[model samples]
Target: MVTGDLLMAARAGDGESFRALVEPHRRELHVHCYRMLGSVQDAEDMVQETLMAAWRGFDGYAGRASVRSWLYRIATNRCLNALRDGARRPRAGATFGVTPPPPTRLVEPNSLQPYPDSLLDGVPDIAPGPEARVERREAISLAFVTATQSLPPRQRAVLVLRDVLGFRAAEVAEMLDTTEESVTSALKRARSRMPRERPARARGTEELALAAAFADAMERGDVPAMVALLTDDAWLTMPPAPQEYQGRQVIGEFMRVVAFRDGARRYRLIATSANGQPAFAAYGFDRGDPVGHPRGVLVLTIEGDRISVITRFENSAMSCFGLPGTLEGSDHRDGV
Candidate 1:
């Protein structure tokens, strides 16, 4: 049925019609929320709220705007509300008094989560079109999301709507209930504050090769070889822990002391992708357990041939990447 027919049926309380109308936009809307909140869990919550709000208010959704725009309007405002409530601020870093390494600014910690590629399968390519300066994939990069945290909630919304999603200034203004001039000004400021350069490209045979080698080095307990894969100004950070290790020397030292301390049995890495970048799930073997358990998810930021940043999340996020809660058997080659 046409969207108009779906809308009419949806307004009359046809649940099936409502689902059909909204399902196509689900993944993209979820991604929109993720960009706004910088937390997958939070984004998931916001998407639920947006959908609920949309369903309840479907009758009142005037046809002045497309259904997609109307949905974005609701989602954007929900994110703004969450931001204004200060309920989604970055958490404090690790309690240890270790100073952040040089060249790596330990910004206030936030509830950053990795986005699995598996979940992105049906997400429409809402990337900016030919006229847009930003690449569609780069807009979803972890680097871009992290940089966006620095923007005020409204400005962040403006930049994402206008630049990232390729929405017109007038349409964004309508969504935000602001003037087009205001959106333009806010977007300009947001652009200035965001990171100037996109991080190393996440897709390519070379990138895959680099990620494979990194995973191989870790799996084989080759610390030196692993360290060689990093740039001199590399960074290592575990969020909600606040401790950021910068520089290859500092990162290597910490890896030796903590990550690889108990020989190669400490952890095993399975290659994966998160936030559109190379990532891995680090499974650590318990003292006597036959199998290693999920420890944490590590995402690497590459620059040229070397990795510049390594961000690790607590083990609680294993399921977000569609990983098994426990590695049942010795065979870890499932997802690699």
Candidate 2:
């Protein structure tokens, strides 16, 4: 077969043929590792390890399974090993100089990072085809990814492979080096932990309208108008800092004391999308600078017409989100 010939050529030290065989699956595999590890940098490292292992073990590849499946097997095992070693979990709050409030019952994924839409250019939009049961967008949402972090490592892998990626039970078992019965058992527990449906969030024109109104209020320091757009139980969190503010009263206090206390700081918000949600790249001006420097990235979780959660990440991560380090001119706004 053509693929067998290519594999043979690749093993014979033909670098071009090897790349031709593996290049197509690179992005998808990276996304898979991101879901497992919850960090983009970790995912990138895992992908390199997977490919290197494949290249070194080429002789053991009997061509019984497709190259894609083989690569996934390698990657999955690598991630599992990393998890077992505790080498990749989020650091403690004290390490970041954060004093976390009493632990709430709600599960929060630590060290959560945003996935840029630009990196998703060539990735296929996963939909419920005859083979796949879950929509691609739901699988990649920030909420969903955070929820998976609560599950045990094996259960997480089973749920993602079975439901998100649409891999059959037998296929998943083979990948994990387990029996189908074990895979089914793990999947049952995983599904029970997952919500019956993805959480409802504003979409399309409604989402655009909300984001615009929210940005406008922040720019003008309109506290009441900003408060009007939040759900009663809205939550605000800035990761790497364990502080979380919930409920309208507490959030308003946060806005008044921390954000708008010194008066409105000049900001420019450029629209972007992350984790299948609307996000903005925020740029703040120094006293007399003509242009603004990156402040942070804000990702919103909307429930119905009101925003439910605001997840803000540090400005140091702006580069990964495909945002420029500086914005020029007095006014820079991009309509969503």
Candidate 3:
């Protein structure tokens, strides 16, 4: 059935029609919420709220705006409301056992979480609008999302609508219930404040090879070899925690003193992908258990043949990627 027919049937209180109408946009809307809120859990919550609101207000939907825009309007406002209410903010950094090197600087409080590449599978790509400058991949990169964290909630919404998701200025204004001029101004400020870092150009074969090398070095407990895979100015950051390590020397020291403190401890890296980058679910064996226990998820940002950034999340993030909390020998080869 055409969308109009679906809409009419949906408005008549046919639940199946409503589901059919909205289901196609589910993944993309979740992504939109993720971009706005930065946490998969929070994004999921807001998407729920958006869909519920859409359902409740289906009778009132004027049909003038496209369904996608209407849903975005609802989702964006819900995120803004959460931000304004102070109900959503970065969680505190996960506590680490080891005492190690001093950080270069404390990064801003970021509740940023990785989005599973698997969830991105069926999300239909929308071409960038005329004024949109941010590419699709960069929009979803950890660096870009982290930079957006520093923005005011409204500006973040505007930037994501206008630049990231490629909504037009007028359309964004309508979504936010503001003037087009306001949207334009907010986009300008947001663009100016965003950190200029871009996603590394490495992709496909080069990315796989580099990630495999890092994994091999990690499994062998070779900190130096792992460090060799990093670029000279590489960064290592743990989200939710402000600590950021820069440069191969500093990062290598951090790994030696903290990550490998148990003396060449072998790790199991279950390969995965997050935020369109190669990631692994790292595990360590317990004294009695043959299977490895969940440690954390490590996401790598590659530039050319070397890793430019390494961001590790707490073990709690494993569930977000559909990773099992514990891994048996047979589970080793399966991707999460």
Candidate 4:
């Protein structure tokens, strides 16, 4: 049936019609929530809440806005409410292991999680309006998402709605129940606070090659080779761990002292993509084991020919990317 017909039937309490009307929008709405909340699990929870609210309040959805816009309106507010109420805060004091070194600055355990590129397939790429300043891929990058986490909740909402999603200021204002002037002001501030430098060469050949080299270095425990692939001012961050190491030298130390500490342990990297960047499912094998146990996921941020950031998420996230819990063939005769 046509959307209008489905909308009519849905409003009349046809569950099947309502499901049909909402199914296509679910993935994009989840992406929007992920951008706002930063955690895959929290984003998913908000999407569920948004849909429930939409279903319960279907009668209030005036036809003035397109269904997508209507749903976005609901989803945005739900995230904003979640932020304000502190319903979801960063998981605190979650450490991976012993501290590596003094960080560049004091950083809390970041709750931010990587979004699998697989989830992004078929999601619409174009901004809905002309005001979008961030490109589709840039908006979903780990760097961009982490930057957004530093903004005030409202400014985050405003910037994402007006600049990332390209909702008009008026539309954003309506979504947040504020004035267009408020949205404009918040967006201006948010844009100014955002990192001026966007990461480069996403999913391109250069980025792929860099990711491959890093993976190789990691497997062989080649500290210099891994450090060489990083930008001089590169950063290595493991979320749920407060430490963040910066610069090639410091990152190299952290790798030698911490990551490659057990000389007999070997690593295998299974290539994947996350947040529009190159990533891997890292598996580690003990001294004599042929099976590699899931360790964590390493996501790389590339700029020009060098990698600028390496963010490692815990292994609990592997299933989200369709990665296996264990891998065989530890011989490493043919490198990944």
Candidate 5:
């Protein structure tokens, strides 16, 4: 059935029709909520709220516009509501009273369900068309998303709707209930205040090649070469664990001495994306035997041709990334 017909059923209190109408958009909306609210925990909460609000108010949804657009109206409002309630904690690095300890390798990764890229499988590719500007992907990286943590909530909402998701000015105006001019000005300010990006220094599928090279380097435990693949100021941070390490000196030392410093570890990629940028689950293990099993799931972020960040997440993000328990030297020759 068409979306409009489904909405009519949903409005008539048919929960299954409403579920069918909303299911396709769930993962993307979750990603949208995640972009709007930096904390994964908070994003999950807001999505739940968005769904509940949508279901309870289905009867009031006017059919003048697409159901998708109306749902966004509800979701963005839910996020804005959460923001206005003042529930988020500010970044601890510069703005807070006590800087928390950095994330350790022993930490557990967030328990959030991984969204399959297959969401884009059947839907039209609304993400930056491959032909779009390069910065489009850069703007979606975790570092960029983390940097956006500093924006005022409303500005953050507008930017995500307009830039990240590729919503038009008029559509965003309807979503936010603001003038298109106001949205434009806010986006301008957002771009201005966003993290300063170095021109993407590396070229020619740098991220993919870098991921492969970095996997090789880590497998060989050649800290120097792995360090070479990293940007000078490269970092590794795992979400749900607030510890962020900066600079090659500190991060390289940690990777060399603590994480991969001693073991002959192997790796593989479960292809994935994080914070809207290129990502993978790099599974690690001590030996070629399938027994000692899958170890760490690492997420990489590339900048200019160098890997600017690598979050070696703890736990089943490895499986979530579709990687197998790896031997220190092999990935079962399964291609990503």
Candidate 6:
């Protein structure tokens, strides 16, 4: 059951044991890749690359480092090289099942494209056990990921390895090919640059209750109640579509025209978190059976008592969010 045994078995040509050695780390490694690449599909691909490299280069191992550390080492370097390669740009093909209705008239002064649940929420919530889940959830929200996205590559790696995953500075330094002193300095800077957490905290578990109410209102096409939940001058956006809408009426109208609000019911949410924001996978059902993860992702920006903005990720990049044609098939489903 030990990783060393699996590695030894793998070296002796037991591919299944080698895969078993690395399976537990795969999801978390994708998370690490997401942090480094900032694209879900890219992260998934990077994880695959890292694993394949590990397999092919098994002979190079001198057992100089722990297996966990060694895998991270491969992943971190792969992601860094991905960033340097420039051939990969963040794609916009992401889609959302739920989108904020756009305005027919003049739009609000401020707006941002809403990333879908699959895209914004694709973070793999890979806590090792029940005891660690809550702590892990708090650390992987959208706000946190957004902040990390701004960090320099090395510092980003340091913060993730040190603070998020609980690695010591020595371990982090070894992973990044640097000294512990440098790792310490990077963490300090990363912490300082982190954004001030917003005043409107995600309702956490209360999201299920809130989602139920919202679903009923949406099914009946109750514009007023839906508007009531949103902030004044709320912004709505869908990515890869390149359209923006602001304010309550415009948002309402867009919803009517675009969303298939005809006789919908039995809406179920996948119950996830993103960017530290509360979110859901948002499955749809007419009578009972599920139809889609169409609103592939939702990231809400709250400003006290009201939902200030909502972004619907449109699966812009074909590969980045790990989305195939539909959620039933491929898109990486986690953290949202």
TM-score of each: 0.91, 0.89, 0.94, 0.94, 0.70, 0.67
**lDDT by residue (tens digit), candidate 2, 1-336:** 377788889888887788889888889888899888877788889999999898888878888778988898899889899999988666543232223343223344376678887778867554432535567888888888877877898998888888888788888899999999999999999889987865677789999899899988776667788888999998887775667788777777766655544454566788898887888988776457788777788988888999988888877668787678788864656543
Show model 5 residue runs off by greater than 4 Å.
1-7, 16-21, 39-45, 84-123, 127-136, 166-174, 177-185, 196-198, 201-206, 240-243, 261-296, 314-336
Clashes of each: 5, 0, 0, 0, 6, 32
Ranking by lDDT: 3, 4, 1, 2, 5, 6
lDDT: which candidate is best?
Answer: 3
**Residue 246 accuracy (lDDT) in model 1:** 83
Root-mean-square deviation per candidate = 2.8, 3.0, 2.1, 1.8, 6.2, 7.6
List ranges where model 1 is wrong by over 4 Å.
91-106, 126-131, 199-203, 262-265, 286-289, 328-336
Better of 1 and 4 by lDDT: 4
RMSD over all Cα atoms, model 1: 2.8
lDDT of 1: 0.81
- Candidates 3 and 5: which is better by lDDT? 3
Task: Score residue 159 of candidate 3 by CA lDDT.
Answer: 91
lDDT of 4 at 182: 85
lDDT by residue (tens digit), candidate 4, 98-157? 556677766866678899998899676544589888888788999899999989988998
Residue-wise lDDT of candidate 6 within 1-336, one digit each (tens)? 777777788888788987887776787787778766566667778999999999998767678886777898999988888777865654444343455454434322221222234443444444433222124644555556656776777777777777777777787788788898998899889878876554555464565455545545554557677677876698776543456678887777666555545344333334444555544445444444433444555566655656766765542432233443333322233222
| lDDT: worst 10-residue window of model 3 | 327-336
The candidate with the higher lDDT, 4 or 6, is 4
lDDT, candidate 5, 1-336, per-residue tens: 877678778999999999998877776676677667755556668878889998998898877766777777888888888778866644322121233334334333332223334333433445542322325445545666666666887788777777676677888898888899999999889878886655464554766677777766765667788888878888777554555677777776667545653465455545566544455565545445553345445667676778887765555445444555543445453334
lDDT tens digits, residue span 62-181, model 1 = 889988889999999999999999887676654432333343455566788888877678798664643356676777777888888778999999988888788888899999999999
